[model samples]
Target: MTTTRAHGEAARDDGRSAGRPSGRMLASYAAGSVGTGAFSTLPGLVLAYYLTDSIGVAAAVATVLVLVPKVIDVLAYPLIGALSDRASHRTGYRTG
Candidate 1:
């Protein structure tokens, strides 16, 4: 004979994926994204100000300095994503 269990009892059988992300995970992702954005933008903002005013560099040059690095950073994103996928697979987690 087979027995059936309620939803709560079934959830207790497996430790993962009872539902969507918890509040803690959502908060952590939000904070981490903000931190990373600050780290990336702070230097560019300072340099743009210094180059256009204190250093007497042209606005074009300042823009180039600010934008080129960002462009390069964008280009690397896909490769980094692929590398992360490979690492996950190596660690025995499927991308699916």
Candidate 2:
């Protein structure tokens, strides 16, 4: 089968123009994933380890410290998503 892309271009399910990302784009995406993963994971691991092991804080206290921000995020995300959706609806484009 075929699909019509923008500008009246015909797209097909064949491997040639099936919208698969180029190798360079895939490599860039992989690098981005690794960087993003390290940035997101390392801080939490280091912070928890530092708080408990180096600073001699209690485990429960360290857990709470880490969790409190996530609790706020859990609550805030829905509100933020709703606000962005509303803003987009009103303006016909995303606010940011």
Best by lDDT: 2
lDDT of every model, 2 decimals: 0.82, 0.83
**Model 2, range 1-96, lDDT digits (tens) per residue?**
788898999877545544456677779989999998799768987899999999999999999998888788889989999998888877886322
Model 2 pairs whose backbones collide: none
RMSD of each: 5.6, 6.0
Looking at model 1, the pairs that clash are none
The CA-based lDDT of model 1 is what?
0.82
TM-score of 2: 0.59
TM per candidate comes to: 0.68, 0.59
lDDT of 1 by residue, 5-96 (tens): 76534324333465566678789989999999999899999999999999999999999989998998899998998999889867976423
Q: For model 1, what is the alpha-carbon lDDT of residue 44?
A: 91
